[model samples]
Target: MRLTHSCIITNEVKKLSEFYEKVLQIKAETSGDEYAEFPTDCGILSIFSFSLQESLAKGSSLPGSNRNLILEFNVANVDDEYMRLEKLGVEFVKPLTTQPWGNRSFYFQDPDGNMLNFYTKVK
Candidate 1:
């Protein structure tokens, strides 16, 4: 099956959604108070409140949370993207560097502690 969206659950959907908008320049739509979504070319990046998800799922505990998940955004130039994003006060884990996998990448953290990587394949 094809994936249409990726979700992030947080206490502050507005704050988290604004992060993507102000930082990555994503346009997000808020559905009432609980949900907001960014319609990216890859898929929709969404955020929702824990209380809302709980109400729908009938008591599902939150995940422990790990760094294993990364939201990778493809860019034409990794270093250029890094400079632009860093100027906006983004915290980066790694600067522009070519990985063994043949991709130049820059890693950073989102407001919700989500790891994000902007990269480009090196030919």
Candidate 2:
């Protein structure tokens, strides 16, 4: 089966969604006060809220409250993308570096602490 959409749980979904829309140039739609959906070239990007009390009661942690997951965006040019995004005030874990796999990449974190990587093939 093909994947359709993926979601990140945040305490402030609206704010995070707006950040994505503003900084990453993603146009996202909000559903009342619950969630946001972004239609990308490949698939839909979704963000929703997780009530800490309810999730803790159910013994499940919020999606990004813990590590072990990473979301990556592939770009045509990592350096150009990094400069553009940096100008928009996005925080990067590190500047774009060339990987042994013949790609230039960098890492960052989302509002909820989900690790993100942007990569492009090195020529």
Question: Could you say which candidate leads in lDDT?
Answer: 1
Tens digits of per-residue lDDT for model 2, 1-123? 888887777778777887788756878788777788988778888887677435545645455574787777788788888998888888998778998988899988887788888899877
Clashes of each: 0, 0
Task: After superposing candidate 1 on the true structure, give the runs of residues whose Cα lies further than 4 Å from its correct spot.
Answer: 58-64
Task: For candidate 1, write residues 1-123 as lDDT tens digits.
Answer: 899998887777878888899766878898998999988887998888988888888566363264679999898878888888888899889878999989999898877678898999997
lDDT against the true structure, each candidate: 0.84, 0.79
RMSD to true structure for each model, in Å: 1.7, 2.5
Which candidate number has the best TM-score?
A: 1
Residue 13, candidate 2: how far off, in angstroms?
A: 1.1
The Cα error of candidate 2 at residue 18, in Å, is 1.4
lDDT of 1: 0.84
